[model samples]
Target: MKRALLLLIFAMPASLSLAACAAAQQTQAPSLAKRPIEGRFDVAPPAIVIPPPGPLPSDLAGRLARWEADAASGQQAFAAERDATAALVAAAAGAPVASERWVVAQQAISRLTAARAPLSGALADIDRLYIERTVDEAVDGLPDIYALRDRIAEMESAQDAILQALSAALPGQ
Candidate 1:
């Protein structure tokens, strides 16, 4: 037992030391592949710039009791719409969503397109200064909805191009 204990106690430290050295050497080696982007669920609350205390729309009064709450809800809704569109990009060749998801996304986009029409002036340093009512008003320059309209135009153009190419490839062409 004495001999065994002497070997075990002394040899154990040497064995452990070798294992530690091996681990350190392994860690020093360069990785063969790029690391993936980390999935972060830590969503920071969005900072909202609320429109001023203009005359509240009669219909909106009930939905927007407190200015902060109304702003938060609007922001949250917009965020959901934005994320859905991002997913639609990965949902295959077509829109990434389907059924109710597609419908809701389309509706949100439509509502957002309308919402931006009256945002004529360049964005103010502080969004709270704008009259919330005016956001729905039709301003100049393609009516503040150029972005959404442009997207539609691009989609139409792409479809037309595809059709044209197909026609050219046909046997009768």
Candidate 2:
């Protein structure tokens, strides 16, 4: 009888200790707002000073002019494709989107892909010129160059959405 009583006395405190530990864990976690932020939240964009246009070498001047022309044409084509896609969507508003809509979407994707090349080429030219020329010499048309790059990227995203629709509409070949 004494041995059993002794065993219960020792086991009771150990079980009570475990219960207290579990109760401590059941307390609410620390609030997230109390924690300090670890890293930066806001970063400012770099400044790009566009200087006055300097006299250009004949070859570079001619190349820039050609690039401008190509960019203009590509922009026009992209606009046209966008309009066509919008028209197709408007026309099919009531009906379930048909395979014909997928065809139109595929065509739009192809046109967007074709139109991107020239703008990409123009951006590459700007990058090359930036590297080759002095800062002042390179800054004259920087805004226009960046605008074309941004426009192309936006169009690429639009094309990607259309491509996704096409794949979903006509899965596998």
| Candidate with maximal lDDT | 2
- Cα lDDT of candidate 1 equals 0.43
In model 1, which regions exceed 4 Å deviation? 1-65, 90-108, 111-173
Candidate 2, 29-123: lDDT as tens digits = 77767344543554688899965664555666667678777766766676666666555544444444446755565565566567656766665
lDDT of 1 by residue, 1-173 (tens): 99999999999999999999999987867777745554364578899986434443454444323433333344444444444443432332243345554555455445543333222111221132234434755233222224333443443344345334433332223
Q: Provide the global lDDT of candidate 2 against the true structure.
A: 0.62
lDDT of each: 0.43, 0.62
Clashes of 1: 2
TM-score of predicted model 2?
Answer: 0.42
* Residue 159 local lDDT, model 1: 36
TM-score of each: 0.21, 0.42
